[model samples]
Target: MKRKLSILLALVMILSLALPMMAGAETVSLAYKNGSLHLRKGPGTNYGSNGYVRDGDYITVLSKGSVWSKIETSAGRIGYIKNLYISGNGANYADGTSYFGGSYTGYVVTKYSGSSVNLRAGASTSTASMGQLRNGTKIKILGENGNWYLIETASGTQGYMSKTYIKSSAGSSSSSATQYATVTGSVVNVRAGAGTQYVVKTALTRGTTVKVLEKTTSNWWKIQWGSYTGYMSANYLRMK
Candidate 1:
């Protein structure tokens, strides 16, 4: 009995020492736009897309190649993405930034700061907000007008961001682009506008999937739930 106990303790000690190393694997976040970066079975695009990671999702980098990189998603599914789409050590890469639907011209990297930067329909703050770009989000500069930079997001969201909140960066990537949000509050009230002062249009239960139309600079999401359109507090939302 004593011998058996000693052997078990030795095994436990070995496992305890090995556990940290196993969990310490290098990890990186996928910076590509929504539905664009495919986690493939092989290092190239020809391989089957076994899974996918969107902007702001973190995964483990197993190995890397010149054009492709092997990665394991947080879900433990192994795959590969174009080497350009993954960022490490909180760093951003310029070559991997993707653009869409505009005059095919040269691209420049711009940095955004603050909790969120409003992408507006025009160059002024009074213009309608098309969406909100998260902090560290990179904008591919298409053109510039005065203090505003005409930019495009990975999801093809094109708008102008103020020059005040933007800095010319070496490079950056889309961090946590809004795709969908799951309601976390138990029967949270849905406001008609982006604030509490607005009327309660309806209520959404926990686990309800909300169609994220766009985000306001105030951190409210204009969402569509069951044919009712309104804004909700972004604080109670979770992304899958």
Candidate 2:
């Protein structure tokens, strides 16, 4: 625990120091050919590769140099890439600004259920505030830069947020996350949506155990049965 705390503190301090240089950091896109461009811990191939950046991927150039450029990837990783691989071209948003794009899903995981996390214009804490997202809120993970994530809320609000406060799953794979229930009816139909109009995804036998993901409504609950995730009527499910 002490080691973890020390590491977290050290990382925060490092990011704090990097905030100024990243404040006005030039955002750019990668310009590599087929295959991925290696992101190294140092500026040269002599340095170890830490990650891969595809062609045209958005990156924030923290510090530019003649031969090498220190950058933060859209996935929140910091590394160095060759200067020749950096390009100024990218998709321009309606606001006339460049933003990263992604299709994965994630949820806000704050310290407390009532607490919220800040959204900013840039990855640094010193950036302009955009808004806040509350715990348990689902978001579209656009990309990550530094230790921050570029996310879009369900309401369409997009901005950068600390990556530490979000998770890829609805809950951790732990005993506490085991919200179990039993199929009450002899056989129950699990639909793709919350209503009968949706297609039946699968069928659950009587007394079959399932993991309840969310109680979408008093009548319908989203559940996980074996490998299937769909909605089942609450009337046919008895929470355990």
Candidate 3:
């Protein structure tokens, strides 16, 4: 009897430590635009509604099937949510700053400092924005910079934002390479071809951070990421 009791206590201690790590491993966030999302008892809509979830709710995504994701709610409620309604905005990469393989139902201001904040593009000041920001505001970071960031707000406002006001408790992977640039205050045209006069794919916003693949000339650097690519103003990128 004594030996059994001792063994039981030992098992309990091991489980206590392991449980917390496992619980923290598979976490995800709800999208800011998501409202009245149904939580099912299992990883399928056919399973039946376990409860209703709102925006800004933090949940743990345990596993995923084709269209449904099994999530553990904050209240210890386990259920499923459809993938279509969830925004996997930061779900593509595992880089410690992004939430990959999961859904974000709402925007949670991860960081908050003073009442004012400076928004940037691609996570740095090299990116331009419409203007400054305030506190308690939720924004989505499209990309990351060296301590700065590029973020989009709820009302379809896309621009640059500082990292000081945003925080994320989700798991992140290792960081990637550095892509820095300068601001020439010019509307650098992003082209599909690598020349001065190609079909203008899109116009780069002022202070946008771009990854420099190769410097085609003293004035142009081949860059691409997330959809846009082509020749941008060399003066705008800080090539080392």
Candidate 4:
């Protein structure tokens, strides 16, 4: 009876440790690619190609070895790809460890002004419009399909938006970034319009402080730089 009790206790301890390890497995995805990327059945090129992932193909990263990672596609296909090709919100780790830093995420910014991008039920423009994302509304990207990205607004609205009208950033910015910013880049150009097609007014050297006048609907900051008010790409400005 004593031996049986000891065996049972040992089994419970092993199960307890393994349970959390199994629970920690998480989802990750292949980063954006212009062309098709292949997923092999095993971790190396010697393995057979099992499937392919496109521009916004999201997958679950199962495990990471030294050079390759095992992943599962949305369609349930399992395969491996080079670790360098994988990108995701690092919130969860494949080895059942949690990332101490913030989880990986992406941002969505409007491309142009005067119009809102339709959030649809499907990737195509013809799909049902679930809602609209206004200019400069930052959203957390969840996944992608073709030229469309799956995103969720801060208000918890989720849908698809065309990639053409919205730009994707690697992570979120400080809440005050839209209100005030500092120039981080050397000689950043101040443009007449929100986009590069606009005329260049002048250039601001690094460390210049600018008042946050307005964030144009197209991701440009309309700023006041010592009375020379013009537009600059939001990318170069860091929130004060």
- Please provide, for model 2 over 15-109, each residue's C-alpha lDDT reduced to its tens digit, 9 standing for 90 to 100: 99887545534443331122266789998778998978875566787888877888888678899986655555432211222222114567888
What is the TM-score ranking, best to worst?
1, 4, 2, 3
The lDDT, on a scale of 0 to 1, for candidate 4 is: 0.62
> Measured by C-alpha RMSD in angstroms, how accurate is candidate 2?
18.8
Clashing pairs in 4: 89-104, 90-104
Query: What TM-score goes with each of the models?
Result: 0.36, 0.32, 0.26, 0.33
Model 1, which residues run further than 4 Å from truth?
Answer: 1-25, 31-36, 54-58, 73-76, 90-218, 221-240
lDDT of 3 by residue, 1-240 (tens): 999999999999999977754554443333222335678887765678888876545566777777778777778787887654343343311122321111122233434455566653234444333456676565555443345443557765544355455554232311223344543456767777666767888777766666655444234556775586677655455432
TM-score of 3: 0.26
Report the error of model 3 at residue 124, Å: 22
> How far does residue 174 in candidate 2 sit from its true spot (Å)?
16
Question: What lDDT would each prediction earn against the true structure?
Answer: 0.63, 0.68, 0.53, 0.62
lDDT of 1 at 64: 77
- Candidate 1 local lDDT, 1-240, one digit each (tens): 999999999999999987754663443432223334567898766789896676656666777787778777777788887655555554432123322212222223335335677777556686557668777665565444455656777777556677566544422222223346788888888898989999999999999998777655465778887789998887777643
The number of the candidate with the highest TM-score is 1
Candidates 3 and 4 compared by lDDT, better number = 4
- Which scores better on TM-score, 1 or 2? 1
Q: Report clashes for each candidate as comma-separated counts.
A: 0, 2, 27, 2
> Measured by TM-score, how close is model 4 to the native structure?
0.33
Pairs that collide in candidate 1 are none
Candidate 2, 220: how far from true, in Å?
42
